[model samples]
Target chain A: MDVRHLSLPELREVIRRGQYTGPTPGLAPGYAQANVVILPQKYAFDFLLFCFRNPKPCPLLDVTDVGSPVPRMVAPEADLRTDVPRYRIWENGVLKAEVTDIRDYWRDDLVGFLLGCSFTFEAALLEAGIPVRHIEEGCNVPMFVTNRPCTPAGVFHGPMVVSMRPIPQEQVVRAVQVTSRFPAVHGAPVHIGDPEALGIRDLAKPDFGDPVTIRPGEVPVFWACGVTPQAVAMSAKPEFMITHAPGHMFITDPKDEELAVL
Target chain B: MDVRHLSLPELREVIRRGQYTGPTPGLAPGYAQANVVILPQKYAFDFLLFCFRNPKPCPLLDVTDVGSPVPRMVAPEADLRTDVPRYRIWENGVLKAEVTDIRDYWRDDLVGFLLGCSFTFEAALLEAGIPVRHIEEGCNVPMFVTNRPCTPAGVFHGPMVVSMRPIPQEQVVRAVQVTSRFPAVHGAPVHIGDPEALGIRDLAKPDFGDPVTIRPGEVPVFWACGVTPQAVAMSAKPEFMITHAPGHMFITDPKDEELAVL
Candidate 1:
């Protein structure tokens, strides 16, 4: 079955029913997919502020009301506890369990945040004829922790983490133009060339995800990665945290075009 | 004294000392003046979501940590509790007091938010040779409550409020081009012509602020007003609310040019 042809509700239903248990890349093609973060109400304010301060890495899509499982704005009918393909439960900043649903661990104080994911912008890049190295290599995009510190908000503070793509030197301008259109999803390149400038020592050894080939004519372009917020949240070592494991994203009803500003 | 000549720190010190008690208009020229809203932390999450939902009316510039008096991003050294020239205190949705400073009423649970004001974009308009009718008339800008309902978040929900200026039909495109550059400050006009289309029965009698004249050839242009969030916050009738009194904004360290995107 082609998941791209399925509607948002249908796609979410499949995930909810445990029929789909895989990374959501290329699923529900035109719909927006989000990075998920769930924290107790006590930490909601700081996390929200963290997203606001570091918009490039944490462009907030929608935040569920405290104790509520439904995301009123983004996906009214979907349940945050059961809608995603996979969930990672973190206890005191350490990953404790991976599950298909978090219903057993649901708490009244939990506040869910849906952040804009780069998958939306990757689709935009492909449409604009810019090559995405990770897509070509059939692997996760390379992500590295940079020396740049994110603007701190309360307990959340950490260095910025960025995802890298190797773009031909000639098409760097086009890559920036295409990604700029999607500010909600890690818009524009943070650094177009020179990985060392951001304090990344080795391109071949990424902190997360698989490293893609960097051709001689290609320049390594880096974008503020969605992982920064989750990483920061983890560093704070909150009593509890919940997230969609890696690329197993939460799909929303909003179309990818809905996020475009111009 | 020419307020434009004064440095940001100097201007803030004057305002803090209560020596400068006038409206912030044309004061601190080239610096960004912000619409202030200080609310109890209990209602902060809802209000933050409200601003995020309605970016046009409430383009959030900076938000302080709970119980903190400093606006760390926009005006790090300025004290939010007393830096503004005047403040309006509300209790149960009723105006309780209008004071020069809010230091006496500051609480540990309070959170300060600095929202972008239209003054920055207005300055851009004037620089582009487009005449702002209200500035020309030497009176407050006319504001109206439109029939359009804002996307609500939690307890904060209300109709969008808009400020109007009469522009010659020939310069409408230029007005849009100039204003679009300052998305942080209300961005482009929501409606360009025909007041009746927005359910605005009479242009002369505004819902808030002073009314400006609409000349024979000029069109009534409406942009989302900064008052929407404050009005929405007031409508929720929280136990407490604080805001800048009309034109008495909180001047920030950010320059007018910094808010422009291009």
Candidate 2:
């Protein structure tokens, strides 16, 4: 079945019923896919501040009401506990379990945050005729941890994590233009030419995801990644944390076009 | 003395000393002036979420650490308790007092939020040769409560409030182009023409501030006002709320240019 033809509610229903358990990329093609983070109410203020302080990496889409499972803005009918394809439960910042649903782990103090994901911008790039090397290579995008420190908010603080894409020198301008329109999703390139400028030693071996080929005429472009928040949360070693595992994302009802301002 | 020539810290210090206790419209010409809202920590999450959910009326410039008096992002060395020229204290949603400084009222649970004010974009309008009628009239800009409802978060919810300016029909496009650059401030007009469209019955009488004349060949253009949050907070009837009295604003160290993009 072509999931692209499905509406957001229909797609969410499939994921909820455990019928679809795949990476949400290219699914519900026009809808925005969000990065998920759930934390106790005690940490809500600091985490919200962290997102506000570091909008590039943590562009907040919608935050659920404290102790509520529904994302009133992004997906009113959707349940945060079961709507995502997969969940990674973290205890004291360490991954403890991976599950299809977090119903058993649900708590009254949990506050869910849905952050804008780069998949929306990637679609924009493809539409603009800019090549996304990782898609062509059929692998996850290359990600690296930079020496740049995110502005701290209470207990959340760590190095910024960035995703790299090789774009032809001429097309670099177009890539920046396309991505800048989607500020909700890690907008624009953080660095254009040099990896070492961000304190990254090697491009061939990324800290996360698969490394894509860097062609002769192309330069590496880096964008702030959603992973930065998850990584930062882990490093803080919070008493508890919950995140969407890797490629598995929470599909939001907001259309990709809704995110584009211009 | 040309207030524009004075640096931000110097102007803030002057305000702190009660030597500059007037409207801040023309003061510190190129620096950003902010609308201040200080609330207790208990309501901080809901209020922050309210600002996020309603960006136009409440474009947050900076939020101080919970219980901290300093606005670290926009005015790191400045003290929120003493920087603003005037403050209105609300107890149980009723205006209890107006004072030059809030030093005596400071509390450990207080959180100060600096919201972007239209002064920055008004500067942009003047630069583009668009007339700001209120500035010319030497009175406060007329503000109206729109029928439009802001996205509610917890207990903070209310109709959006907007400030109106009369512009020549020919300059409406230029006005939008100028204001669009400062989204941190209320970016662009929420309503371009026809007061009836916003359910505002009379242009001669405004809900707040003084009304300026709308001349021939000119239309009323409205931009989201920073006052919306204060109005909403008052309506919610929080146990306590503190805000900058109208006209007297919290001057930040950031230049107006720093808030602009592209």
Candidate 3:
């Protein structure tokens, strides 16, 4: 099945029934996709504070009521424990298990947070006729750990991680303007030309994701990445955490334009 | 002394020294002013979630760390305990005392939250040649309790409160366009032209703040007010709560233009 034309509920149902467990990049193109983070109630305050303090990297979408598997604001009809394509369970900062469903791990004291992802803004950039190198190369966007420090909150703190895309010099301003419309997603570029200014030493290698080509007349534009919260959370070394595996995301009900401001 | 010429730190110092306990409308004109909410650590998470779910009425500016009075993001040099000119201490939803300082009541487990106020966008509206009736009349803006229910978070739920300004019908669209630039403050009008639509019975009788005249050619425009969170928090009847006296806001270091998007 192509699966690209499925409705929001149909797509969630397909994932819920264990029929699909793959990357959700283009499956539901217009809808907003989210990065999931589940933590115990004790650490929920600090983790939320971290996201609030560092909004560029962690634009929070919706937070579930404690111990409930429903993200009330974004997609209340969807069951978080089974709807996502994949889940990574972590214990004491270490990756413990990868599974399609987390019904067995769901506890009464857990809180689920859904954060906005860059996919929303990338769609906007493409619509504006700006090239997104990773989409053009048919691979993951390059991500780098920067020297920029995130504001420390309670038990959460770390350096910001940013995703890099190579855009032609003339189109850089357009890219910034296009993405600035979606602050709910990572809006605007954090850095434009110098990689070393962010203390990122090499373009060929990245702390996460695949490296892509930066062609002539194109410059490396960096955006705050969704991977930041995961890295920061791991650094905190909580007793237990659950997140969507790389490339596996939770699809939301609202269209990408719904997140665009003005 | 004319307080308008004082810098951010100086203005805070004036309030800190108990020399200024009056309403802070025109003083330090360019900088942003914030509504203050200080709650015990036990209720901080729910309140933050409440603010997160409802951005228009409660656009969160910055939240202090647990047991800390310093709002690290907005004004690190100022202390929440003494900077605000006046504070209302509440016990079980009832007003306990109205004082100039909270140091005597401050506890190690309290967290301070700074929420964006309409003052930021009002300046934008004024700069755009839009008439703000309250400022013109030298009185508080009219506020009405709306039928619109805010998306409820855990232990927090209530109707949204809105402040009204009568804009000339010719400038309603411009009013929206001007205010839309600052989402950090109450962004855009929630309703326009009709009070009955928002379940407001009488323009002369507002739930809070003094009602202004609706001129022959003017339309009453309503924007989500900063009072919603305080009203909702009071409705929840937590053990203890502290808030800035209405119109006496916390002055932030950033100017109004800094909150503008695009």
Candidate 4:
């Protein structure tokens, strides 16, 4: 099956039936893929406020109507329960299950939030001749927990997590220029060259994801990661929550260009 | 006193003390002024969602803690009750009173919202050499209600209200380019050239504010106005509401450049 040529809806429909469950790095090439966060109706206001307060870490793309699995703005007909390739169920902040669909766990009070992911900007960077080490190394991007505390909202507060890439000394400015266009995603690098300033003690070992090799002329650049909200959720220990499993995101109809500034 | 050279807190202090009641056009010079909206907690979520849905019309800058009267993020020391030069009170969609302070009406459940005002972009436009007709005419910008309905959120639903400015044909592109930088304020032109496209019947007679002269070679450019939330609040007619009267706005500490995307 030549999935590369398939349309967005066609690709999602295939995932909904439990036939496909894997990383969605290159699928649906030009469309935006979003990080998913669903919480009970009681927590909706705080979660939404949290995203508003910290736009860099959590750039909200679309929010589903309360109790409705459909994200009307991003994907009107797509069902959140089944359309996503994989979902992680969390109970009181503990990961309880990793499954293909959350139909059985669905409740009427759940509110889903789709946040912008980094895939769009990474593509732009690659197109501009900047090398992405994770994609080249065939490993997950190196992620670390920073000491910088996110501006807290009601019942949600924690330090930020950042993804690191070693950019060549000269391409650092170009990398910043490229990523700054997509503030809907993680935006530009939060820290460059100095890990200790972010309370990161080691570059070789990250708290999450695999660490990539740093070439001779490269300097470490860090960006606010999407894992921030999840880490905050874990710390808060909300009664119930659901999220898209790592790299298995929800694809939206809007193109990456729609989110760009220039 | 030279109010233009006065600091933000000092200007706000003057307003708080009832020493100033005039429109704040050039006051506090480079600082961002905000459109104030105070609604009961019962309506905050839907109202915020409404703002989220219609970003151009209602670009939110800061939201105060419920009943706090303190906008922590924007100006930690500024008090909402007395900082704005003038305020309009509405009860069940009807204009009730105009007040300098609302200490008597203060409620434990009220939520104050600070929305981006066009002063930020207008400053940018003037700096970029684009002539703003209303400013040149020394009159309030003309505003019209459109046939297009805003994406409704709960009980808040109404047509978009746009503020019009006649721009020279040569400067239209520059106007768009200049304003596009400040998305926190009403970003870019929603419509240009034809008023009929937005269902605006006559340019001379606006639903709100004074009409300006459109030169022979000028095109009528419309922007999503900050008046939208006020119009919608009137339509929804909740138990009680409060807003800054016409041209009297609350000023924030951040400069015009702080709100810019680039």
Candidate 5:
């Protein structure tokens, strides 16, 4: 099925029916896609603080009211439990099951947080005529667990994770300008060049997503990735947590243009 | 005393020693002044979320680790309990005391949040040759509680409060441009003209702070004030809260230019 042609509600309904369980990179082209993180009421405070303290890595999009599956701000009518294309069930920070829907695991005291994803910014980059190597190569954007540790909050503490993209030397400044407007989605480049600076050994092999080729004269530009909190969630080992499966993001009604500032 | 020449540490030390307990507008000319909010760990999450959801009204600068007296990020050596010129002690959301020091009320479970104050942006406005009537008339900036309710988070909910500055019709665009660079502060104006649109009846009679003269050929520009979350705190009525009193603020080491974006 060609999901790219569907509207926001149509796409969500398709995912809700379990008819589409795929990554959401190219779907709903201009709309914002979010990283999902749901935790028990006990860990909600610490986790929420975690996002506030580390905004570049965890730019928040919308948060659900306590025990409510609805993301009241981003997509109120949408049911988070079943709308996302796929869900990851983690027990004590260990991924135990990947489910098509999380209705069975829904709890009375869970708080849902939806964070801004880089897809919105990536679209901006592509529109500005800047090449997104991963999109060009049809691969996941390369992600690395940086040595830079995130500021800890309560029980949540871990190193920051960053996603890297290659851009020609002339386009680096343009890339920064385009992304700077979208601070809600990993803003500007954390590091412009040199993987060794971030403690990454090889550009060809990423710790998380698939790496793309860096063409001649192209430098790897690092942007704070939404995946940092997920990694932290696993390392901190909360008793229970739920996250969107890799690349299966929760789509929101807000357009990419709305996320831009200035 | 010529307090204007004092460095950040020096100014803070003088404030801590109780030698200075007055408004901090012109004291540290280039440094950033912050709105202080101290809450019990239980209410910290809701308050932080309130700031995140309403960025214009509550642009957070630094949030300390839970139960800590130090603002680790902004000022590590600075003790939040006594660093500000004055503090307001609240019980069940009602102001019970305004003191220079909060040592008697300091608790182990309190979390300190430093919110970016408008001083940074106002300084920028003046540097750009845009007039700020309050400063010209030697009074407090006029503030109004608008009809727009902040995006409620947890138990915290209240209308947004805005500080108004009348700018020449020609300089209104310049005012927005200058403040836009400082998103870390309250950023750009939320409402430009027509006080009644925000449900504010008399622009001359403000809900808080003293009103200033609006000369001819000028339109009142309203920016989301940092005072907002404080209003929310009182109305939300958490069990205990501490904040900076009136114009007294926490001055930070970072310069005004450092808070600018892009």
Candidate 6:
């Protein structure tokens, strides 16, 4: 069965029932997807401030109330516990268990955060006729840790992580314009031409995800990556945290167009 | 002395020493001004979430570290305690005192928040040759309690407050186009015509600020007001709070144009 044609409720039901436990790339095509982060209430203020300070990497979509599983702003009817395809439980920066549901680990102090994912902007890029190399290569986007430091908020502090997309030199301007409209979803490129300017040593070897080909006429454009929060967590090492595993993301009810500014 | 010609640091210095304790409008030509709010660290998270949920009314400009007076993001060297010309001290929903400095009132667990003000967009509208009625009349912009409800977060919940401006029918589209660029400010108008639609029955009697005459060819336009947080504070009644007194705003280092999106 084609998952792309399914309604949001149908798609969420399938994921909740353990029918499909895979990366949520193509499912629910036009709707925005989110990167989930659950932390104890003690760490929530700092994390929220971190997102507010470093908006490019951490464009907050919606934050759940303390102990509540509902993301009231983005998706009201959705249950965060079992809606996502996969969940990662982390203890002191180390991955503990990958599960289909987090019912057993739900605590009253846990506050869930849904951050905007790149899938929304990539769709905008494709619509604008700009090529997304990672999507073409059928692999995860190349992510690298940059020398640029993110503004610290309490216990949250780390280097910014960025994702690289090779666009033709001629279309770089258009790519920037298209993505700039969606500030809620990591809008616009951080750096355009030189990777070494960002203190990146090698383009072939990325810190996370697969490296895509950089063609002769293409320019590497780096955008603030969604992996930044996870990378920050790996370094900051909060006592406990939960996130959507790898490519698995929580599908939202709003369409990608709704997130655009004008 | 022409206050408009003073540099940001110079302006700040004058305000710091109590040389200038007047309304900040037309003081600094192009610099952005912020609505200041200081609260105890305990209420910080809920207030931050409230701003996040209600972006239109409370577009966050910068947030200070706990017990720190400097707003590092928007103005690093500036001091929040002494920079703004005047501040209001509130205790249990009642106004306690209006003072020039908050140093004596500052506590270790307090946090400072800088929210975007309409002054930036008003300047933009003026630059576009659009007439702002309040400015023409030399009075405060009229603000009204709207029927629209802001999304509640934690302990903060109330009706949205909006400031009204009269614009000619022909210039309404341009007014929106110009203001839309500065989403960091209030952005576009929430309501274009008919004050009654927003539950603003009589334009002559505003809930706050002095009312201005609406000319024959002009229509009332409402934008989310910075006073919304204060209104919410009035209703929710946090234990202690500090806010910028009316017409007195904190001058930020970044230029108003810097806050605009392309």
Considering every candidate listed, which one attains the maximal lDDT? 3
Q: Give per-residue lDDT, candidate 6, residue A36.
A: 95
Worst 10 residues of 3 chain B by lDDT: B1-10
i-RMSD values for every candidate model: 1.5, 0.9, 0.8, 1.2, 1.4, 0.6
Q: Per-residue lDDT for A60-168 in model 1, tens only?
A: 9989888998888889999999999999999998999999999999999999999999999999999999999899989999999999999998899999999999999
Q: Could you tell me the C-alpha RMSD of candidate 6 in Å?
A: 1.2
Which residue pairs overlap in candidate 6's backbone? none
Tell me how far the alpha carbon of residue A77 in candidate 6 is from the true structure, in angstroms, after superposition. Answer: 0.5
lDDT score for candidate 5 against the true structure: 0.91
Better of 1 and 6 by TM-score: 6
True contacts kept of 6: 0.95
Model 3: per-residue lDDT, tens digit, B3-77?
Answer: 878877888899999988888888888999999999999999999999999999999999999989999999989
Residue-level lDDT of model 5, residues B1-262, one tens digit each, is: 5677887778888999999898898887888989999999888878887888899999999998877888877787999988998999999988899999999999889999899999899999999999889989988899999999889988889899999999999999999999999999999899899998999999989988898998899999999998888888888888899999978999888899998987
Name the regions of candidate 4 deviating beyond 4 angstroms: A1-5, B1-5
Interface RMSD of 3: 0.8
Residue pairs of candidate 5 with colliding backbone atoms: none
Better candidate number, 4 or 6, judged by TM-score: 6
**Model 2 alpha-carbon drift over 4 Å, by segment:** A1-5, B1-5
The whole-model lDDT of each prediction reads 0.91, 0.90, 0.93, 0.89, 0.91, 0.93
Q: Per-prediction DockQ scores?
A: 0.59, 0.66, 0.82, 0.53, 0.74, 0.93
For this target, which candidate reaches the highest DockQ against the unseen true structure? 6
Give the per-residue lDDT digits (tens) of candidate 2, residues B1-262.
3455676778888888877667787777788999999999999999999999888999999998888999888988899988898999999899999999898999999999999999999988988888999889988899999999999998999999999999999999989888887889988789899899999999999999998999999989999998899988889898988999988999888989899854
lDDT of 2 by residue, A1-262 (tens): 4566777778888889887777888887788999999999999999999999999999999998888999999889899999998999999978899999999999999999999999999999999999999999999999999999998988889899999999999999999999988889998889999999999999999999998999999999999999999988888887988999888999888899899756
Instruction: Identify the runs in model 5 with alpha carbons over 4 angstroms from their true place.
Output: none
Tell me the TM-score of each prediction against the true structure.
Answer: 0.94, 0.96, 0.98, 0.96, 0.97, 0.98
lDDT of 6 by residue, A27-116 (tens): 888999999999999999999999999999999999999999999988999999999989999999899999999999999999999999
Docking verdict class for candidate 2: medium
Query: lDDT per residue, candidate 5, A3-72, as tens digits?
Result: 8899998999999999999989879989999999999988988888888889899888887778999998
